[model samples]
Target: MSTLEPVEITAGSLHLRPWRPGDADAVFAVCQDPEIQRWTTIPSPYHRDDATGFVDGRSPANWATGTAAQFAVVDATSGELLASVGLQDLRDPAGHPGVAPGGDGEVGYWCAATARGRGVVTSAVEVLCRWGFGPLELARIRWIALTGNEASRRVAVKAGFAIDPAPRSLPHPRDGVIANFWTGVLLP
Candidate 1:
C-alpha cells in the first residue's frame, strides 16, 4: 500500500480536509438525514459506531492504502462539518490502487441538510476536481447518481461533467444490485 501526503483544500467559502476523529459527532448527525441515506450508499440506519469507525478508521486507512481520498467539507470560518466528498472507487486501468497519475476514479459527495441550497457542494466539487487533476493527476473522474436524484445531478453538471446524451442505466457496485443511475464524466 502506498502512503499519500494528505492535503487540505480551500474553496470560496468551504474547506476540505481528511476526516478526523473529532468529526465523528458531526458526521453522525449529518448522515442521519433521510435524503443522505436515500441517495448515498451510507448505511440506511447509520449509527454512532458507523460514524466513529468512518472518521477514526476507514477514512485514514483508505488514504494510507491509496484506495480513496475522502474529505470532510467544513465551514471556512467555523470549522463545522458540512459535507463528505471523495475520489472513490480508485483504480488504474488494470484495477490496482490508483495512487499514480492516469488512473480513473469516481467523485462522490453528500451534504448536510443545513448546508444545502447554499452552492456549497458545487463549489467544493469544483475545487476538489481541480486538486484531483493537479496533484492526483487523474485521467478522468466519473459522477453517478440514481435516477430521480435531481439535486445530485445538478451538482454534477455545475461541476463540469458532460453527462452522457442519453443517461445509461447500470449497476452501481456499492449498492450491490444497484441499477438505473445517471452517469457523467470529467476529463483532465
Candidate 2:
C-alpha cells in the first residue's frame, strides 16, 4: 500500500485541505444538518466528540494508512467550513496484494446546510477526481447516494458521473445494508 501525504486543493473559491483540530465546532455544526444526517453515513445524533474524534483520529489515520483521502472544503475568503469530500476504499485492484489508492476508489461528500445548492460540492468533487485520477493514478472514482438523495445525485451528475440508478451500493459498516441507493461512475 502506498501511503500518501495530505494536500490542499483549490477549486475556484473553495479550499480543500486536511482536517484540523480547530475545526471541531464547525464539524459538529455541519454534521447536525438534516441532509447530512439522513443521506450520509455520519452518525445520527451527532455529537461534539464525533467531530473531535474525526478531526483528531479518523481523518488523519485514513490518510496515513492510504485507506481514504478526505478533504475539508472551506470558503477561501471567509474560511468557513463548507463541505466535506473524499475518496475512500482506495484499493489497488490489480491483483496486487496490499491496499493502495489505485485502480478504483469511491468519492463521498456532504455539504454544510449553508453551502447546499451553490455548486460548491460539485466543484470540490471535480477537483478531487482530477487530483485522484492524476497523482493518485486511480482508474475510476465512484459515487453512491442513498435512494431519494437527489441533491447528491445532482452533484454527481454535475461532476460528470453517469448514474445507473440501481441499488448497487455495497453494504456499509455504519449504515449496514445499502439496499436502496443509486450508484454513479467516473472513469479516468
Instruction: Give all candidates' CA lDDT scores.
Output: 0.87, 0.86
Best by TM-score: 1
Q: Flag regions of model 1 displaced more than 4 Å.
A: 172-175
* Tens-digit lDDT track of model 1 for 61-148: 8898888899999998999888888988788767687566788789999999998999888988888888888988888898989888
Evaluated against the true structure, the overall lDDT of model 1 is 0.87
Each model's TM-score? Answer: 0.94, 0.93
Candidate No. with top lDDT: 1
Off by over 4 Å in 2: 95-102, 169-172
